[model samples]
Target: MASHPNSSTVQIVCHVPDTLLDGLQVDMVLHSHAFVIRKTGSFRNHTVRRVMTRAPIIITTIRGGLANQMFQYAVARRLAYLSGGHVVLRLADDFEAQHERVFGLRHFNITGHVMYESKLAVTLQQLFPAHPQPIPEKIIVEREYQEFVPYSGKPALAGLKTLLFVPELLAWRDSIQLAGYWQTERYFADVPNLIRHDFTLKDPLDARNQAMLARIRSRPSAFIHVRRGDYTSPYFARMFGSFPPAYYHHAAQILRTRFGADLPFYVFSDDPAWVKQNQIGGPDAVFIDWNDDAPQCDLTLMAACRYAVMSNSSFSWWGAWLGERPGGMVIAPRIWFKSIPEFQDVVPDRWLKI
Candidate 1:
């Protein structure tokens, strides 16, 4: 994202780091400090262009780990794609470094952004004109995952039922802020190929992962995720309950019925000790416990397997999505969360909810 202004003329040449799925290359021409893009081949470089007084600033908080970052990013990317805007993934808290959880979005080739802000509302205030109206907490509240209410015509202080897309939130225009953990593919459903490309790792797997990859793809395989780490706590357990061994037992059974009795099960987990103690993936299943320092490798191996038995965790949810092949099976828990007893849109319709 470099801009070179011709010293001899009033033209500005800009190289887009990368645009959305459209493969659109944009070149910006500076006009009075206001900016926009020019499309060349249904996308463009330096022709007459589209002008924007203020492309809306779609701000979202970046918290949790990789999967959570992915959710936050994908939703923000979709919003910016739909209505013109610049994406801002703000660091919501400082606890991530202490937890050894990095902001994983930078590892992927993603789009729809100007900056990843860390300060609270200062960036928004600096970017936008002085407030036309006061914003309550400076975020627009989307009522829930179920309802779609158009923006109420303010710099909305939005809050809501999260983990799934709600369309009414799209009505928000101009500078707006968001704070939610958006899961599920519905937001980017129409462009699965685009999302896939965007989420693909920018680099190849390491030596350990490459060896694991070969091993995973060699057999009639299924991957089981036992997500325990934080789920053992009282708060997380009550809000989002951990899966019991029974869930994996039933899922493995289903996979065995389809793939044959010898189908090898590869287990991935944050707490492999707990997994072994509970015999979550069965006594014969192979435990993949070395990638705690590099969870992406674990995710890669999970995606390579022919079958996936996911826990309620988003980490495995992503692995299953990336690994889904023709004639493959993905088994999700019938109950994803203890708080929301009814099923959410997190699981795809084609996946078996057992």
Candidate 2:
């Protein structure tokens, strides 16, 4: 019932140092960093203009929904912090055109410079003149290296992580762009408070949510998240399947056994009607359907809980993670994706995989 460091572990084959242990508390080679970060400050130039920084800026793009955007920002943010670099984001104009998503990073207290796409190329060339092929060598996708062939090559599933905390990345001196999901906690494990604070909502919760927050804090509470909507599409359905009713039944029982039998469960889902019909969170589960259009509010409510029954969705994963307490329990599905059997890096080592 208690969360401890991970015992059994896997390695990131691409120059990921041996001491960088994921779940174990041994000689941690994974704790490697190689950068001389200059302190950032503003100075006045001879032109009477403000010079923000001389430090290299790691420019990454944000082009996904709320949870996805968070991951993109987090990895880049951690890189900047470790290397004494700054983050410059290129918000894609086509995300809204392709998917029903707007630039979602503004909702949190994220620190970064947003560059217009029109000006990005000129700035990149000015910043790093040594790089060739425009930015090809600088662009880091999750599978840019040869080690990813086992999982990404598609001949047969040899099972590799969706992404890895490549130790080589820490030694980079020039600016780079991250184009992968980078959905692993190892990126920011040592800076929990900093990451949690950055994810805090910029705006206050609404009246309805405020009352709900009070209720959640008043007693022993747990949250349940069900991912539907876009997840029902064939692409998403094939990548990550939904959890069955039995999984929830057993997860809820696990919480009840640990925290009291009548532990009140607050449910957050894309489909509240389906949840109510199936009683996924149990009959007395409080369905939070009001914040569908407002993810920040919904996540606030989810994180307010002391425990969580996580859906195999990044949205739910963050909710459980953000609100985690000392002895809190988070129950996640054993399988994250149907195709990527080796990509289990997304789940935290402390969480229970049932």
Candidate 3:
């Protein structure tokens, strides 16, 4: 089976002799089929059977840090699963050089594959030469040739041919190219087990993180994630501001009262100094200063904890979601974004929001 250069559908090419051509029958497998037959010679007949074995291709542009990438991947995975399509993760290269945002999905045990923008552009050029506008050099930039599906908190139509998810819509089409940080649990709630399996870590924790993981599992630990850095910047603060100090304090108090005052807090943060200065965890907490180079390690440690006090960041959100315990508590800020009004879907219904 070979994948189409322009579409996500895989072509199942089959060759049949001229003698058997009349009697040959192809069964409808997963979804649909596009059959092509050609005569190679006077006595020989070549039958090329192209079956849409996989769902329509959902090529989504993945950006930001690990958690954000996971969000994009999960949405695409669910969409593909529902529509019987394949997913091609288009990693945004512009952020790689500027923000050091590497395509970190490989670090997880995800089933989907990824393609570089340059390779996708070359494939498009070879496939669609008659197209007027060139594919944008940056995947984030809008182009007329691409079909972008806008999200407005509604389920997408069933019969869409080629849908592109830019932000708002939840659509199911034969083929779609999605681009959004779909932070809602509702998108993948039906396939929770599949997502949990896919999001598992590809590699085991290293010695340093493993030791920390042991400590996290040893007690009634509460994982507290403090996200600063980018959120504190003047421009980003307006849109994605840091959770106020009071939020953390309230979350800690709730966790302590629910669990126990002696419950040890495992603190994870991009800015360890800021966590130290703020004294977010207090005397009973352990500050995990290591694993700056390995962010997934931090996530693993966070999940290992029995309870969680998450930040507004998606990074911490995944930590809490993955590490969720049956009886344990997860406290999050009611407000996810400072500017956005419709982030109610970001947090799960079960998780408490202070």
Candidate 4:
């Protein structure tokens, strides 16, 4: 019998440094390739064949930080699963490399297999009958990451519960009036798995979170995440303009008026103490325990919250997306920054910008 061309086979190349290998799993490796058919009972008169996929799924931190890397894995996994193939990570996308490299293939020294699918391939693949549909048409307008243009279906990864907050990706973005505004929104709103990654809070804070979660007692409750920081500084809120203390003050007032004090309000932030020091804590406001020794609760707590008050940072964006707050509020900065007027429209409709 002739082998089926659709039979899947994969070779993976790990893109991340060996140091973080412990965080990955073998099964995840299996999740990165196109599905292939494997013939069972070889060399027998009564041989049977069944579809099998044990392809390699490689992971690399080519571009961006932990969030970007996670996104790469999620996309690779989804493509492999949907295409009936395996996955692989070309680490070449890792640390910024010299401009003269030969792209993901030559950079990663991958000769055995092809990179997931070309941008054209991905786009053309959308024409076929794929699950979840081709991410709607508006998912690719004004995308910040040109390098990832081929991976246009990225937001679709959100459905896998993997969230991304790439403020830096917006560094090049000077305007949001561009068509891609809705594209980013769809990605942010469409989440399936949402892996939490914040390590900012401590155990006592988690205990407080548990208490707060318990307090709802069937009452509709939401988590209000407020992040205040220097907006002008290129390091943090460079894209979303500045989320001045005034916004926090105004938001707090609104929360007070809308939710009232009976519903417990849990504050999770990089600078929780700062909020406590400056903003007046409400009667229902409970500051979760956060200390240096606290277990890192970046994505964990963000995922648990029913609602979110996103910071100008990508970190908070993931929080809001993962919360999946039905009828929830994700308050973001209306004006990202003065210089980067481009970010004005970067936020989604679900967000109540201050």
* Alpha carbon lDDT of each predicted model: 0.66, 0.69, 0.67, 0.41
lDDT of 4 at 304: 67
Candidate 3's clash total is 8
Single out the weakest 10-residue window by summed lDDT for candidate 3.
136-145
TM-scores of the models, in the given order?
0.73, 0.76, 0.73, 0.49
Give lDDT tens digits, candidate 3, residues 1-354.
776453454556666565765433222122233333332212122444333443355677777788888888898788777766556677544547754766677667775444555556553333233333223212322232234323212343222222222443345544555565667777677788888888878779888788878877877788899999988999889877887667887889888887788888888988888888888888667899888778888888888888899898888898998888688888888888777656477888799988
> TM-score of the candidate numbered 2?
0.76
> Where does candidate 4 stray beyond 4 Å?
1-82, 85-219, 226-241, 280-284, 289-296, 337-339, 343-346
Tens-place lDDT digits, model 2, residues 123-235: 45443333342232355656523342212344432222325556555466655666667777877787778889999977688899999999999987999999977778888
Best by lDDT: 2
Runs of candidate 1 exceeding 4 Å displacement: 1-53, 93-100, 112-165, 170-175
Clashes of each: 12, 6, 8, 46
Report the C-alpha lDDT of model 4 over 1-354, residue by residue, as the tens digit: 233243443223234334433322211212233322223211111111222333222222234433344344443333343334433343332223432322222111111122222222342232222223322222222334444444445553221111233333223221111111121433322234322221222224456545644554345544555555444457654444545566665666665567765544566655666767765345446665552232224444555655566656555665566565566666776765454555444477657887
* Candidate 2 Cα outliers beyond 4 Å, as residue runs: 1-52, 122-137, 144-165, 170-174
Stretches > 4 Å off in candidate 3: 1-54, 93-95, 121-173
Cα distance off (Å), candidate 3, residue 18: 42
Q: Candidate 2 — which pairs collide?
A: 6-23, 19-28, 19-29, 19-30, 20-29, 20-30
- What are the RMSDs of all candidates, in order? 8.7, 13.5, 11.6, 13.0
TM-score of 3: 0.73
Error of 4 at 51 (Å): 12
Q: Per-residue error at 342 for model 1, in Å?
A: 3.5
lDDT by residue for model 1 over 1-354, one digit each (tens)? Answer: 222131111223233444442445233334555455544222222232222224556776666688877877877777666665556666534435554676566557676433333433443443333333212244644334223222334444345544446666655445556666667787667666766777776668888778878888787689999888888899899978887788889989888887898889899988878888878767788899897766766777888898999999999899899888898999998777888776487889899998
| Best-matching candidate per TM-score | 2
